[model samples]
Target: PRGLMSLKSFRDCAGEGMKAMMPANTILVLAWTISGVCRDLLQTPLFVKTMVADGGISGGLLPAIIFVVAGFLSFSTGTAWGTFGILIPIVVPVAQAVDPNLVLVCLSATLAGSVFGDHCSPISDTTILSSAGAGCAHLEHVSTQMLYACVVAASSTVGYVVSGLTHGSLLPGFASGLIFMVVTMLVLRQRNKQKDAAQA
Candidate 1:
């Protein structure tokens, strides 16, 4: 009797797996290279001095700024890990310089923003893998997920601002963000229902 698992079947399976992983591998390499360069630049004294001297980046808005910057970087690179590697070292010191009490808040903002961007980015490995796993169009998956990601990001931005203003208190900031997210989601659902009714 023939073996249940043929050599030809194994070869085909391996080939398909490698093909599915190629995009993620390529993105990882590119993201790591870019992060290395950014890490070097960010560590320079000139860059640190300039950043610390920037008066606008201080006070109760610093966490919001950091969150936005982290989000944009991760979204453009499509790699949350790379974003974290690039931003954490730089942002942590800067936050400490600006306000010692805000170190944890800024760190949390960076993490949250990077996650939000990775979730929404079309080229992110997680996004790509999710679409492939679901057997759906990649762009369709990104488009569908973008709305929800944006809603959460908006809420998080508000939370960051509140946290910064309140000197890093978690409770009030979290409560405000949760309220905003619930209200926004409800509004979106109501609008969708109205549109569906009108179409029907």
Candidate 2:
């Protein structure tokens, strides 16, 4: 009986397939969890107040700022849902106070930013699962995806700005942002081609 079963067969039967996958990645998993907790702890009320302060930050800029801030928070925490839970309540009231009209745009920006950051963060569960599912190194997956994430984020930032300026009308902002993203990608592709040619 023992001779008939190979190590691979035993591993498949005893849940070793799942258990073996975790030992090497335990440190990384713990580190990510700790960092997320620390980030949440440090999200202070003063920071929220400063971000929404009306003197220097105009209504037109509010959405863009919220996007940037939410992105940073989500990236640090590696959790888009957590970022949304923390930010939406604060964003809504502050945006309403600043300009009741800008509230919807600001909320939209916040949600988009959270997703953008979580998509890119190495510590995010989706990112981890994606790398694992692809059977690639986690860091390799993160590095490869970072460029695209940054490009999308920049486009979203521009879109949020336009939406805020237009009093929450997203169509024009969305169109312009799409155009900007396409043009930027084309330019980058051309540059990469030139570099490859030079190398050759």
Would you estimate the TM-scores of all the predictions? 0.78, 0.74
Candidate 1 residue-wise lDDT at 56: 50
In candidate 1, how many Å is residue 89 off?
0.6
**What is the alpha-carbon lDDT of model 2 when measured against the actual structure?**
0.81
Q: Enumerate residue pairs that collide in model 1.
A: none
Worst 10 residues of 2 by lDDT: 37-46
Which pairs clash inside model 2?
Answer: none
Q: What's the C-alpha lDDT at position 174 in model 1?
A: 96
Error of 1 at 108 (Å): 0.5
**Candidate 1: worst 10 consecutive residues by lDDT?**
41-50
lDDT, candidate 2, 1-200, per-residue tens: 65978988887877876786565356346545554454456543335546657346667888999899889988997878777776776777667767788888888888999998889898888899999999999999999999889999998888888888888887978987898899999999999999999999
Candidate 1 TM-score, true structure as reference: 0.78
Candidate 1 per-residue lDDT, tens place, 67-121, comes to 9988998899898887887777677777777778889999999999898888888
Off by over 4 Å in 1: 1-54
